[model samples]
Target: MEKITNFSVRIVQKYLPSAFVLAVILTAIIFVLGITIADQGPMTMAGYWGDGFSKLFKFGMQMVLVLLTGYVLAMTPIIKNALNALAKQANTPKQALAITIVVSFICYYLNWGFGMVAGAILARAMGSSVKVHFPLLVAAAYGGELVRGPSSSIPLIIATPGHFMEDAIGIVPVSQTLYSSWNIALTIGLLVLLVAFFLLQKQPKDIIVLEEKEEIIETKVFEGKMCFSDWIEHSRIPTLFLGLLAASYIINKIISDTFSLNLNTMILIFLALGLLLHKNSASYLNAAELAVKAARGIIVQFPLYAGIAGMMTNAGLVTIFSNAIISVATIKTFPLLTFLCAGIVNFFIPSGGGQWAIQGPIMMEAAYNLGADPALTIMAFTWGDGWTNQIQPFWALPLLSVAGLSARDIMGYLVIWLGISGIAIAGTFIILM
Candidate 1:
């Protein structure tokens, strides 16, 4: 395992392009596939691409806010102190690996974006405090994100009212999917297996030590007289009051809408809570600036993925691909086949909600025809989407940005976990089916 892992790491480090370039490459590949397989004309393909580019504008903003707010929240003194305290529990590299896996699992299991951001931050903190394999640590943190959390995009979107499939599926509740006995068991088993994998992997020498960088310090001193604008920027009162207002709105939403953490609500709560936790507006903005820097990749790359999704959907390629897979599926084999197809489609349309939009209808048609459980089929797609994310650079952008490493540095390690996670997830699908 160690030798193979080393070989894969060297191969990826030598060959993988920058994630942005990879996104471009994916765009080009999808275009060719659209023309050849879907028989799309050049003008039509251009239209699809153009339409696709802007399709994710709203979702892109939500994701960026998730990354930004999560980062700002992590930078607060309280969160930082808690992370540092967690770091102290790890006296050795192996223990540090365990800590990364557990903390990331708990965070992601609570909320996917929180887990992604918090896991990366926790890895950095652990790296600063202990001698550990940095790439493996980051990879392990990402590995914890493979299970679908309740707040995950696709399931939550499906559960919400007026989703694309609302008329077809009639709002399949979380109890039938996210909180299902099958999903709960599978998640627990995945966590346990991943923890064991990290503990048992041979430690590599030549681990990189994280470099310390100077942070923007927040200042409260006014030069002379405090102006109204200066007070708004530097004082706690106005910011705190606004934060309270935001919090009150979120509280009302929870009470009225039930205790669900959908994307919009999660972003709102995180933004408000981040503002509330900071000492003053300056401090919050300073942390926010850092967060923006870390999330630069996400800010730029999401539109490209969105465009890819647009092409996949508008070009009629999603149905072609999904139907090709559905053609071979029996009732007994439908779940696995759909899972495999979803994993393949995820490479092109990387966003969970986006993939569901394109593939959900096709998968539902096949499930209905084959007389399979719609819930199980949906979970299959869920696992596939989460499964390939280990190597997919899209979701890794924010985590990689936070750790200050390129995808090549961690993806090779993640490829190993991808195989492990695939088996566990696939096995569960078989059992449940």
Candidate 2:
């Protein structure tokens, strides 16, 4: 297995392009496919791409906030000290990998945005001292992002009352989708499998460890006579009041049971905590500027992926692709088939919500025709969106940036996880769903 992993790593390092290159290649492929296979005119395809390019702007902003807030929160003095303290617990490489995976599992299961950066920070903390396989530790941390957990986008959207698909599928409650027995079992099972797969990877005699740890610096005092403007800039009043204000809103929502873990809500949760942690505007903004850099690729690439989704939608490529596989599914096999369709489409449109936007209608209609459970189909789609992330570099960029690693450095290992977990997911859909 170690030999296999090393061989896979060598292959990926040799041939795999960066995430940006992958996006451009996907865009060109989608364009050509739109014209040839989808039977759309080139001009029509271009217009579809243009019109649909910005459709994801709202979701894109939410994603950026997730990265931004997560980063800023981690940079706070209290958070940094806590992470450093926690780093002391994992004294060995194996312990570091295991503990990072467990921490990531809990964080990611609770909130994806929080999990995205939390794992990297924890891994970095552990790597600062432990002679661990740094890339492997980071990969283990990132591997826990099932994307189908509490912060899942598609499930929450479909469960919402005013969603676009409501007329067709009705407002399916979270109990039927996210909180269902099968989904719970599937999530737990996948996490266990990831832990097993990642931990079992053979460690090297000379493991990659961080040569230099990122120093957490104290915010220094102003050198000159502090002016009124300087006082305002560093004032803790705004952070206290505004952070508390955001906290109050979240508290009310939680108490009232009205809070759903959608993108905006997740951002607020992170923001409230981040502002409180950073203590003042200057500190928060400085950390924010650092966080914003992690999200730069997300800002650039989301539009390209959105354009791909637009072309797929307008050119009827979504229907074409979905119906092609869905055509063969029997009533008993519908859930498994939907999972497969979602996994395939996940390659082009990496976001679960975005994938659903294009492929949901087709699958939902087929579910009705085949008499399959809509909730099961939804969860299946969610897991499919998640399963491919093992090899998908889109979500890994921020985590990689934080860990100071590249996609090629870890994808070889992730590719192996992709195959292992995919089978487990497919089996669950087949046997249980």
Candidate 3:
């Protein structure tokens, strides 16, 4: 039994790196096809690949800024002192877990990058006393942070076919009518699951051991001590980040107003700010390096998926997939089916926008044919997309790596959390549908 258990663990561990590699290879294949065969000319393929690569690099660099900010904040004596104070107050795992969940949710909604930094900071602070695994805390942070996506926000107005249903059928879909209510239900469900997990888990005594060990060996050392003003200047780029974020929004607004271009302003802003931040020649060069570093994986993989999406569309595989759902879907069960399909696609296409680009139209057409509420269909898509992040570690990779862990290290904990979220989301959709 012991041998078998160890073998299983080893197999799982071995599979992780292979999975990432396979994804990359598949992406390369797609790039080749897009270049060689797709109706889009060689130049178009090159442009698309280049654009994807550029986006990836920009995102990667922004990730670096986030990492730097987190490191600076974590090294602060004030933050350290506060953690020490908080450590004294945490009497139980429940308190620590509650704090973790709340902070995770808040930061995640504010922005995923900032949310990740917040999670690490909070984990380090609370890890002083809670004695829980750092990865587990980080996983919990990811669980909370991924709940809100494009489907839940105003973007859903354009992405989902809810409005069309109201016009055609003269009835509002459950998602359109009860979006907030469903969201609240899902949020509460996730919170309860997190609290329950923390309460039931064994507390780590290692935290106390680690702290004591550090205290004994450490000489009092202060490095880069700075006043509030200096600290503000150092970490002040969040303001710039925000400004870039706003500028992207304004640019999109201008584009929308003039050319009627509908682009993800948030992503555009993140890319632009990442490019503009380093004004100097050296820093500009560094930005290019950073972009390459950050975006290489994404750049490689996106074209492959884009190829897959193209193939799926061209060969009518998407129709077959949608038809499978349509065959079983009734008004009552349509929402559940929609959720399941969205969840499955999310495994391949992790980006909310990307998934929507592929699945949105098909779902809309199905909803219309089935006499189901389009809004409900959209809600189902959102629920599936957001709920699976607890298990789908792709998005959480950057966050986990930053926290000195890997997806495999935290997969078990996140799976448990994802199970909870999945159940909650599925149940809520059922009830509302």
Candidate 4:
């Protein structure tokens, strides 16, 4: 295990390009696939890719805020102190890996956006206190998100009243899917196994000591010489008022929307927390400015991903891939095949909701035609969505941004877990379905 882990780590560290370059390579590959498999004309494919490149601009901005807000909130003195306190719980590399996975799992199970940011921040905190392998820690943090349930986009969408295939699937109340006995059992077992797996892989000789950088807090020097601009920047009253305002909305969302902790809500919470924690607007802005640097990859790389998604989606490549898998599937093998297909499609369509929108109908139709359980089929898709996320740079953007690392730095370590967990999920479906 140690030899394999070291070999994987070394290979990734040596061969993986920077995240931006990887995005470009993916774009070119997808373009070639579009022309060949998708039967798209060269000019037409470029047009689709061009249009698609700008499609995620808004989503990218939201993600930028997600990382920036989360970073700023983590930088707050109170939050930093709390994280440091948590870090002290892990004395050794193995303990740190275990704790990081458990914490990241819970956070992501609640909301993936929250999990993405929280896991990265927590890993960094844990790394500061223990001589843990930073790349593996980040990978474990990401790997923890594989436990899909009601919090996941596809499950929640299917559980909702008016999803696209409402007549076919008919509002699966998570009990039959996410909250099912098998799912719950698998989730718990997976968590235990992951903790043990990470522990065994932790070698004393391989521990990487990461230096936690000191945060520079800016403060107003003189109150006597304060002009209106300085006063506005230094005043706590305005920021406090805005924080209270944001808090009110968040509380309203929880009360009125019934425990709504979606990505938007998570962002708002981070924003409010940052405002409340910092002394004034200027301090908060300064922290935010520093955090923004972390999201540079998102700003540059997401459009390229969006473009690739466009080529795959617009040219019917996703459907071709799904059909290819379906062609080889029997009733017994349908769920497992669907899972494998979803895992493959995830490389193109990284967004859960988006993947479901495209592949859900096709999978559901096959499920009904073949007399397979609808709930089990969708769960297979859910597992597939998570299975490939380990190596998919798209999902890693925010976490990578926070960790100051690239996808290659951690993907080699994570790919091993992807195989391990994929087998677990696939086996569960084959036995239970």
For each predicted model, how many residue pairs clash, with residues at least 3 apart or on different chains?
1, 0, 3, 0
**Per-prediction TM-score:** 0.95, 0.95, 0.64, 0.87
Candidate 2 on 1-433: residue-level lDDT in tens? 7888888988998999999999889889999999999888889999999998999998788778877887788788887777678788988787888888888888788777678778888898899868888888888998888647667888889877689999898988889888889778878888788888887888877688865746343476878788888888788988988999999999999999987767778779889998887778988888887677778779889999999999989998888889888889988888888887888889899988888888888899999998899899998888888878778788888888878889998888888788888888899888974
Q: In terms of lDDT, which candidate is stronger, 2 or 3?
A: 2
lDDT of 4 by residue, 246-301 (tens): 99988886778664434456678878988999889988988887676666666777
lDDT of 1 at 260: 61
* Candidate 3 lDDT tens digits, 1-433: 2343234434545666533665565455555655554445555555555544434343334444443333333333454455456556665656766777776676565455546655655665666676665655665666676566322332343533443433543443334533457666676666777667655655444432112222111222337786765454445354456546666667777878642211334344444554344322233333344334433444455554554555444434456676788788888898899888888767655655556656777787778887887666776887777667565655665555445556665565565566666787788878887
Model 3: lDDT equals 0.56
Q: Which stretches of candidate 3 lie over 4 Å from their true place?
A: 1-15, 22-94, 128-130, 149-179, 203-304
Off by over 4 Å in 2: 213-220
**Superior candidate under TM-score, 3 versus 4:** 4
- Model 4, TM vs. native: 0.87
lDDT score of model 2? Answer: 0.84
How accurate locally is residue 122 in candidate 3, as Cα lDDT from 0 to 100? 65
Residue 422 in model 2: lDDT: 82
Which portions of model 4 miss their true places by more than 4 Å?
149-151, 159-176, 202-207, 223-225, 253-261
